[model samples]
Target: MKTITKYIKISALALVATFGSCSKILEEQPRSIYEPGFFETERGIMGGLTSMYAHLRWIYGQAYWYNTLLTGTDEVTYAQQADQNFLVMDLSGRALMNAENSRADAIWGICFSNINTANGIIEFAQQVDGVTEAHIGEARFFRAFDYFLLAQTFGGVPLDLGAGELTFNTSTTRSSVRNTVPEVYTKAIFPDLLHAAEHLPETGRVVGGVTKTLARLYLAKAYLTYGWWLENPNNIPTYPAADRIDPDGHDAQWYFQQAYNVAVQGIENPGPFRLQQTYYDVNLATNDRNNELLLYADHTETSEFYNGGSLTWGNGGAPDNFAGWMLTWNYTEIRSSSSSSAWSAVSSVQREAAQALGRPWVRMAPTIGALSNTFADKTNDSRYDGTFTTVYRGNWNKAGIQGPLYNANYLPVNPGDAILTFLNEEPTQAISYGAPFNSNVGAGVLPGRADFVISPSGVSRRIYPGLWKLGPYRTDSGSGLGEPNAGSTRPFTAAKFSELYLVAAEAAVKGASTRAGFTARDLVNVIRARAGVWRWDNNGNTERIEDNSAAMIASTPAEITIEYILAERSREYFGEGYRWHDLVRTQKWTQLASSYTICGPNIGDRTPIVFQRNIENFHYLRPIPLGQLDAMEGDRGIYQNPGYD
Candidate 1:
């Protein structure tokens, strides 16, 4: 990542107020009110350290872009197709143009921001008398972590080792993509991580400081990346040929083994942390310890509350609650009192909408169907239950009303328009539909009705039920009038612990060859047992589909190669940002090109819609933005990567 300079331009006198003791900490100080001299005091130094924590916030929050755009797209097979979503572009053969167009820029910005904050903290904390060595170690650990993110994203980013010299200008050009992947791993990230592992106490020492396990976790990830990056057989300095090799030509296996060793160390000496037991425990709202796997970050309730809702609209509420609309109600069936009666009333309207929209009412393509069916069969797997809600209908209640009878699966009885203006109009008369409701309601109130009548033929009348149960509102009437408070009382966002288990499983599988402590089959069985699978076995012949029930279980080690790992990662971490990088790292861009189909205004009938995976060059790199290139002076070799025109 390009290390952007952020000089704290505060007055020397005001610095005292800025870095003073926690009691004297300025809650409402002006942004420009800084006093470098105050930074000399113990309280001032601690205050400055608080600012570093704030910087860490940016890193944790910024992962959503990768989670949403890269992972949720065809980059990984985690996400199935959806209508009118940007991921469709990648899935449907769209070339990501430059850094400006790609969402990765936000990740770059967040990571660099973390690096700057760490640098500032390290530089300033050293000047204080009572400042402990542990504090300095923490700062260095964060700095290394920030740089690690840069390396993973951009591959050889400029390294900024120390605070800038007086001659350092903000306009100083980027350093050459110096430090090969191995060099960055060894010289920059590894040293800091190792130092952190040694000096940083146990996990509960502080809220967001580095721990021994976290350092190990990061080291494992870095080593894994190193192995992947180095295992290119086509490269000039290839390892001994597979046929001539002693261990069946498994060069990549060595790197995976290193990663595994680190992970095992972390697992054994997990400090104060431990894995979450249940699916609900992993969520930010409910899980207090956050999980043994989570290295650092504030474990406050606000962090939990802030992280909910869909990709389009953040944690849903009054003004910005459009995310509910973006959701296509296809997962569970929307059954009425009787299937025949509801279908008779609503099927024709649904057919018309399908014909006009040129898409199915329930957008379950072959891919989605396959995956959903697979998840259905894997009931024993904790991930299947944790990631998705299996219960067809949980108790539902009206927004303001309070009554046991009122709690039922409330499906929308109308579909007026795709736009929001049509949604606010509530349907009065209930239309009976089958498992998945597809009905519409009309506008305006009818006789003896307080709400708008269900249009016997409109789209709004169609039943599309949301998966989770809605929170209770204030009223006894079931008219859907009350709204939940944003800060308090809202539906919880489920982030299952099963994901952490999957990460552990992958690490274990990769590490099996080197450690001799545990085999891949053993790791797989552990996860299977957790999921309650009766047919669990370590025979190495059991095949498991990535997400779908239809995948043939692998019977051989060759079958459980990188592709299988990628598939498992997709199924386990879908919608959480694992797919995007997996696609790039595994050179599976061609598979991404094959799965998508696009339809919209700017896009015409682009047949055989697909993106070519330029793996030889483009896979490991992204093009620098043309606008940035234009703005920079001189050759600005910094602005252009190797293959761009």
Candidate 2:
């Protein structure tokens, strides 16, 4: 049974004051209106459980920060300038330092707050009468989920299982990095998920319990990450040596097989979700039955509250458009030009002139440049259509122009150029050119010009070529709901089912094959078929079949598995937040950081850059905030992880 918890009406000042005092102060303050005593009844238990779900708002809202920080910059690049914060991080090459304080604080506080609430629920739910085993199972599932996130980011965090037996003490020493990787998995995460699976109903099922399918999903992820860490401990720096339990213990493959088993169980369950026939078919605008592969999702449509819809466009703000909607300067255009004789002449002149002036046009690496060529191919590949919007000629009613116009460079005047024109009241000439042109040009007819010559076709003629699918069309004046420019309203694009197929494929290769489940090749084939690619034998390997089948078929599964996972992730989830973490987890940071280059105004050729992972200071996790450290006392060594000064 679903229940709702109305938010408590406490003033912001009161909340600040209450938490500001030490644990002793907390005791003196008036107790919360709704305490453990109030939640001893069935209705109260239900309300408490529902409040746990409320915490999900914070999690999903915080996703933008994670997605942007992870994807933008050398770690990842925005296709356009709509969301420039992440792009600026890449451009500036700064560490994940205290400079971005609010986001850091939000992440830290929200996770802990959720954990605290879950603790209260878990502790009190046990004492409530008429509360079935299912309530206990839900509380455990949420507790484990919260811990899973904490474990992922801040390794070996203090495990607070319940409200303290003693009074809340602000000066307590933090627990030692207690659980080993396997130990944490076995002790905290796995037990809760297993219990949840036992209590949850079968597929086509929803109750007060987390369904069996959801438990299997969580377990599958745990097993996969565990296997990856055991095999490649060097990649995950946050928990060094945690993966190495013993020199001669069970191999990485064993853990992977376990993950595979759980994934198979989830796949075999008769869930309502499945992959959409095409990538374009998944939309919030359509009232479709959510999909077969969605293990769990917040069904509430609070897009406004959490700003999920705003992410459809670039980062949300004025003066800057959304990141996903802006077009980037196509390096392919520059590369192709560099290779041509005519372009060679122009480039040679530009190069010599720049060299004389101690500047040069930035050039991307040959390998990175190949991505554009690959994407530009107008094939029946599903990704091309799914990922990029097509360019076409159209009138810009605002500008009173009729021709193709690239969205990236859509401003009326080049902000950097130093020229201006003014209207003149002469019959033959409508406007006159002016000198000392430091001001912006106003819209008017130019003298001796018949009409504006808009380019029919060129790189500059397209807007946000690859990242333009954030939402549907809207007027410039922000009138309609779900329109691109509507005030405080935006379109929606949820990442859905097709990704599960990729997950299943990767899981299958790593040991997830069960009798009832699809093989890696089978999963890939199904996805490729949706992309309009015809299937061939290709030796029954997903990676090989998808990535130039002839060449990859000869490679071993281990070699093929990594390659397939990376390529599939890049093609399927490029603009999303997965790439940076993917690179970090696989230990490819140093290579990619050193190899890639950026091009834009103010950034020239030979300008070296490095991602946070490449630097030594970033090896250990980022420091807990200074304020948090100050609140604790004695044995700082126990509180902090290794590698800090």
Candidate 3:
């Protein structure tokens, strides 16, 4: 990422107040007055860090920004036609988003602002005797983390080392040239992380704070991303590269090995982190502070609400709340305000699923092929069943409020409705009509299009399977009033330790020079074992995906390849935010996307949608926001990325 952005939105002096700026550190300044030297004290240090985290949380939690990352991958895709920016991103054609793009600009601003704040903390904290190493370490970790994200998003950014701390004049006169991808990683990212690892404690801190293991995790990720960027098969490196940024030119193999080493260190380290016992527990809001999370963009039920509805009516623009993750809801979930009076020739199981789920904002939908491939082992592979909303134990308080409920499985007259659905299946031995009691029926068959029906009210509802993870069904005081809407309380899982298995396995299969003291197969099998997949040979502890090629099981680790690792990654972190980057870093965007042949039932008349998409090598990085260039007076040394208009 660029080290110094010529144009600065957040002034540096406002970050960590410098010492000696105040007449004396002895005087207690008013609560409102923020001047230099205040940050030298423990209170100022904590306040500065707290403010920085609050700002970071707001930046990372935007629905628009999150959508950009979630959809348009092998695991997920945008479904709504009206969300043009989402479509453009998911379909992969635009070099630059339209001039008024909010998500892109917000991310750019937030990342750079945090970067500047970190720099101030580091500079000021190092000068103070009372300030501890932990403070500086946290600052370094955030700096590295922000830069790493910027590099992944925008290729390269300015290298600013707190040069303008005394002067608040950031946007006017300060000029900074761009750094190369390798330079960002080697000089800034690597060094900051090393410092962070050195100072960050081994255990126990706030949920959002970094640990030694977390720092190591970021290092592994950095090495992998840097390695991939250096040896990108489709795109040539833009040089002359920075000094010692692999001046000797190592191949991707070496980088993968390095990544393996770092990942293994984090994996084997005696830390508080561990995978949750169940896949669903990994993301349950109640499990927000679980051991599986190394670090996450923290949100709470009261404070950091998802607040998606608030965005549309001008209540908030690109708000901080992280709600309405459309990735979890499939196309079938219809808005409650719309038609709900009729069920036309639909199974009772389908009705139960519909009733049980939260509000369906089907902006993004999973392709049928991706779903079939991902959940092929529906009976086992606890992940597939565990993560999705297959059944609904009716809470009559919520269901009864819907009023005049239809399904016989709904015993609202008694305790409540406890029913479930099998989207595509038609199991034997069931009542041909009313409510399905023991709905074990699997997908009966596929219509050439998606499996859905036009309700008797003539409303088109696409009924592919929906994930239960996205439902933040909080209140049921009234029907259709309390559902997952804009500004509603819904939590998004920003990061988790479960992905370590995937990352470690990717490095291992890519032929890490040395073993991680465990084989790639072993790493993957460990995850599978936790999931308790019934299809796998439990006694032998070997996975048994029917379609896994015979050649892949051969003698060497290379046979375990990137493909197997990706499939496993999708199964494990399906709706989580890893899909797009995973595809891009491995140079498999087009290859993986090209595999989509089968499609789901469409709500609209749009015909014959195929899975194959238009992803190009140039799409490896998103275009720098047009505003940034315009801010540089059109010629502040930074240039637009290649292939973007």
Candidate 4:
């Protein structure tokens, strides 16, 4: 894209200090103009490296780019109040995804800009005084980091933006050429990460900076993804029409074994990073930036300047952490009675800056399969409770509505009482529909219950569970509802330590030889064992301490297939922007996510409708952005992916 040419001329810095670290390492002033000779100094190299972390906010937690990761997958679909930005991505024959409207353009622009800044640092930092190889390794990790994302999304990307191969470009050029998939992995991604792993320190320089463990995680992941591309088990198509042959003489089995070896190395020598004691503690907003998280796109509730967005109101754009608002239905519409005798309704549930309730956009909703089939073991597994806000309690007293309000079956509800609940299973008792309460949404009433409820089969687009992990949390919200319109201040998690175990397991499933204690089932059970422990019951709003690890391990099948690993990955990392990449890497998008069931996008609609996606073999690779194709001096047909052209 032309943004690469423009970014080289200007330097932008949005340095943030959310975690406790050395102040000099995390703070820097912004620069307007970046000359070609500026990189020869130590200050210029530090500023450029900090901007690489800041640019991740442009893609990770932004709402539109979040839609590109999830909407077509089996995890989520478009909701009642969805706009065209979310609808076209469902891929259910409503509208086709073309180069213009696909939000993958956000990744194209942001990654290329960061890659150019990294190239400048690596080329000029060696001549500067008192610069170590560890400082240069940080830049190398970010360069490979962005290229791996680009290679996975758009199959073959341009290694040379404007200048020669892997060089920093100073002048503008219009001509571009696409590199092959093997060239990107072997020539750019693998080499940079290998240098980073060898030269980096064990611990990070800053609070969340790059280190040897972080480099090994990405290197192992790239090796595993490249091995699947070489195998081509499903015969999915690639862009630029290159044959699936490694430039090096290694086969797919060699890459898989390398992936397993590196992942095991990272797991053996984890520096200050380990799995959390329970699944609930891993995602709790108060426990953010914990030891389990390796990398994140951080934001602060303390400062609007360092947070890169407003602290009061977010406009749902880049540098704003508003991905949580997309799946949140409007819980403010739920009502209770002012008088128990008549039908005088009072709005019971108000939006608050709590972990369970946040501002609602109603743009995306979870499917029936995600609720019922994926999380079937709700009794023993705590991930379903930790991942979703199933119970929405009343806060009408905090919103200045006193007196005990009446709810379903004419029962009383106070401030902390349950207002609405997304039930775990379909109740055997008869459900009473429409009454003194406003059943405008698809909620029904049970006998002598104070809360309105909707079973798993009754979940609709207008009313469903909110994503509890990504919801809003702030210490400034005292006894009142604090800034509900503001973007979330929590750091969006990018990579974690627990993924090292899953990566080794996936590689072992692909014909890599296993060690004694690190078999495929043994590695997966490490994650499943943690899912059994519970410190808090999220839906019940009570403290529940239990250990069901033996039951969880007993339920595992004797033989673990790739399909079983995919299911466990979903239960562990659902709604964290990992679904599409997982499906694409295994070439199981068409086999697993071809059809899904969800209710229609209306208030009172509850009938499960099965929708079919027109997924073709040519759809394995996403099209190049229209802006990139428009700026280059070549034939557009040759520049784009096959089916989109």
Task: Say which candidate scores most in lDDT.
Answer: 4
* lDDT for each residue of candidate 1 in 49-145, tens digit (9 for 90 to 100): 5555444433333322333334234422222333333342242333444544544554454445445445555667767888776766666677777
RMSD of each: 11.2, 13.3, 7.9, 1.8
Question: Model 3 shows how many backbone clashes?
Answer: 30
Please write out the lDDT profile of model 3 over residues 171-289, one tens digit for every residue.
33434456777777777898899888778987734545678888878878887877777666666434223433474477777878878887777788838889876665665544556
TM-score for all predictions? 0.63, 0.63, 0.76, 0.97
**lDDT of prediction 3:** 0.55
| Residue-by-residue lDDT tens digits, candidate 4, 81-120 | 9888888788888788889888888788778877888888
In model 2, the runs with Cα more than 4 Å from the true position are: 1-34, 61-64, 72-75, 78-105, 161-180, 202-210, 233-243, 246-251, 283-289, 292-378, 389-500, 511-517, 533-559, 591-594, 601-627, 635-645
Q: Candidate 1 at residue 632, lDDT?
A: 43
Residue-level lDDT for 294 in candidate 3 = 73
Q: Rate the local accuracy (lDDT) of all candidates.
A: 0.39, 0.40, 0.55, 0.86
